[model samples]
Target: MALFWFLHLYLSQFKWITALLQKHSEIRMRGIDLPDDLIVEVLSLLPVKSLLQLKCVNKSWNSLISDPKFVKLHLQLSTPNRNLALVQYDRPDCRVLTFPLNHLLHNPSTTIPTHQFICKDNIQFQVIGSCHGLICLLRKSYTSDHTNIHFRFWNPATRVISKELGSFQQSNYHAHDRHRYIFGYDNFTGSYKVVLMCSGKVKIFNIGDNIWTEISSFPRFDHDVSLGSDRVNNGVYLNGTVNWIAFQDDLSCSTYSWMQRDTTLEQYMIILLDLGTETYKQLQPPRGDGVNLVVPRFEPTIAVLMDCLCFSHYVKRTHFIIWKMTKFGFEQSWTQFLKISFQNLQVDNNFSDWNQYQTFMFPLCLSENGETLILASSLPGLCQVILYNLRRNRVERTKDLGRIWSFAKDYVESLASIR
Candidate 1:
């Protein structure tokens, strides 16, 4: 009878332990349920790689990560706050400098230093554009043979890179080939497109389709003279159309005049290529005196300010002028909206005396709020990036990268992981 009692006690204890373990397991599985938005916020704060892997956590998470809305939200949250880094890449040596946007907005009283990175050769740095939480980079062969312009789409946040589209050599496309320009798209149906200008032809590559096509002909420029190397600046993406600044010059003149007098001597026109229609139309700037104003290119042409098409012109030894499109008809009037003066810049050095000839060929990016302009200037041993805040009327030097092409590996790795 005693043995039977002991056996019963042992069995009861075993059963209790088993039951406790089962209950604990159940609690762990459902541990502390969180609100959906809070969970998304927390997940967004995590590195993209971690977030991607967490997609397997459950069906809900998998769906969230794949949703376009979530992708945009996560990108906005991941965007660095009040800071823009100016990176210089020069193959083996690289440098990065960070500047505060707040200073550019309120104080304008700081000079940020640059940072460095080591990278390989043969990596060409091309800034496609920045959208949402990502910037697109196009990597091409560093050589000047005009032969192999292989393109890759990269997302810096995820460090993911897309497969190379194709070789320029194989496609009969050359970067220097006149009359040809190249453009890229993340999605053909998407809004973003990169326009590449070559010698005689302009090639438009839709990011959506990842295919290259030629712009058979451009609106005839009266003069036989060639287009400027700064064509990238002239192309603006707006309302599902890519607008290019076209100059009709006096082909008869020995020396083609650009900003010489700005009179109507050379007709300056704007051409809009609707991505949807795949057709081109011409528009004129309002009351534009083609003089002293450097034929602006690569400046932000499309903005929400005043609900019109805007173009920014940075004149030599003068303030930055903003021209707004009043009417979309054949007689479009470009009214001067804002003029940012040198005194308003509040720089230690006079901006007018600063060599305006030393301009870098990168696009000016606006902040999320659409109130600031990001400018990058590169000199022999020093490279500087500044933010000019329109609303606050201040300018701050945010980054001072010493060398160009210095952030190659970081850029490459950042792009590679995104894929």
Candidate 2:
């Protein structure tokens, strides 16, 4: 009862009188003194919003919550609860949103408003990637195309925004818009890093040192295999590693020289970067024929589902497929976990034929508990999001995002702040 009242009053509203009322004989708040360890443990388990509120509770609370040790420990204790996110990267309303998973699972019909972290009206920003709780934003420069792209790290929890102003800059980057950047956590060093890479150049920015170092080493290029250059790809950060969807040139059997004639299969692979080693490795994903993996909707989005790296593919705007990597670094372990058919989208949405027009859909994410997937499909000027229940194997709550949502991506909140 005391704890409940303490929290209710603590969160509902706290006044200076509330502090003065704690004038007990021992200078305690009605004998409600909590040890430093206890406070750390409790605060670590709380949500980021409540934790942010408690930072202003007192000097001691502020000091404890802001400590780097507490931030790391809190993130460790608060796994999976890292919350889901949505992003709108359109011209006028560039925004990123987030909401708790429990709210969607328990009270989905209640229409909970998402937390809008950033919304710049006229400026354009790309959500390069998100890890722990920090998001990497690449702001397109309007001044000069020759200047390096400006990247910023923003932690909504800490409300600390910092830009990477190092000397590292890309030359003639407009030619390689496919170049990507990822922000990931280094567990061994207890630090954060920004990995910016194109076809040949790779740079790493250490958050602690606030400096960017060029990485000369790279995954061996398959020069023999003919692959297309223009393709859309996204990065997925998992377990101190960042995985990017890439192609390996061809599906020819490397061991048998005669098998090289089978150039029909465009072999797709995962370009993985281990943050600890700051090195790169190429891993082949599950093999599939017939569909060009580099096509618009088929370019698999690397994602982490149920604590495993997954290849999320939207099959030409009709089917959603999830290929799970059962064991790390093993290509044969890639197994097709789920396949949901959206063939009836035309009938359901009252269209004559779904495949007639320039179709589009992006797999937003798998739900926190790995129950359903949040899918967003572009329609004319508006957008729609639907939750596909994996267990039931059906779609529910066909949500119309009301015409403004241009893009969506999965994100989990964390205490990761930029120094």
Candidate 3:
């Protein structure tokens, strides 16, 4: 991979030479044309900015670059160039600030530069999920009677956004009847989809079709083990499915009586919905030998690290451990990725409340080299980003990021179109 990227950079340096060659009479007279495969190979390595500019060079080149196959190829090669899309909602208009991952990784002390996208009409928006280059968002507009909610898709690289697609009324207005939205791609159908989990029911919206269809509801744990709160955010999307970390309480009368004498025995598992099949499946967390895994006072969060589903949780209220799934849907595939102590992160464990001391730490993004991780450590009203060095097992840098709703997402620039 290093050698391939070195060659890509080497070829990119000669872009001016290619333009100069086109001006030469000898090359013009020969009318030499590169083969389609060769053209795609070179173009796919260039950044999205350069490809967008080159599209105007000629009609054939424009068509080749716009082809769906080429788009997929470019996206595959663009993974290493991922960006950090940080969404700040405190402003009247929500702003998505895009920062190059390389810049943040290389210049830890410098003031990083960013590209900003301001929301229109000063409407408030909350990020649902980011996949490919498209960001799914929930827009809330105030009306005289109530708030109107809509779903919108935005591609910051192409600067093309879809109009508000659909509005859903709450199936139940109870206090605990909260809804969560997740965005992902359907590899089988070659479409982008949005999954909505509302009041225990599931619904899907296909971007190309601009239609929402009801799907199977989340599986209910055997009646006694009631499902717990679903305050999940930015679910991990991989292999045509979106996964969330959910818990079930052992609410049986006998279990409740036992809990009074014993301890809380809430079982946490991964709840994933396959986009192709529109069905739900559950996978238990890793139970390594000699390790008793249980849901922390707060909960563990899941993310995609190194293209694998990872689980991050607090251990003994002292260490933060992350586990990665080597194979999707395989319980035994879970491997410990890293373990960092609170002392290493400089976390204060002096809070009066035990739950406050067990702060929620979320893994936001991981560096391409896999040596550093961007984490969001959240307290009641405070949230901050920590850049941790995996090799040294220490914190590299800390930034407040002002105020953010949640952790930043690992974003990529692509030409994936949305309808």
Clashing residue pairs, candidate 2? 82-413, 132-414, 133-414, 382-403
TM-score, per-candidate, Cα-based:
0.62, 0.75, 0.85
lDDT for each of the candidates?
A: 0.47, 0.59, 0.68
Regions of model 3 farther than 4 Å from truth = 1-29, 112-115, 171-176, 221-234, 249-266, 288-291, 294-296, 353-359, 380-382, 405-407
Query: Which 10 residues in a row give candidate 2 its minimum summed lDDT?
Result: 223-232
Question: Mind giving the per-residue lDDT tens digits that candidate 2 earns over 125-229?
Answer: 666667777767666554454544667777765677776544345556565334666668887887878776655466788878888887776753432211221
Ranking by lDDT: 3, 2, 1
lDDT of 3 by residue, 1-419 (tens): 44345445565675532452343334347886545665677678777777888787778879998999999999987545687666676556676666777776776565534335445447776677789888777876765545667888887788778887877544223434446678899988989888876544677888778889986444543222122312234366988999875544233233244333322223566787889888778787776454565544545678888789998777666788888999998877989888888899877645555435333567877887888988876555446667898788777554555555253677788988776
RMSD of 2: 6.4
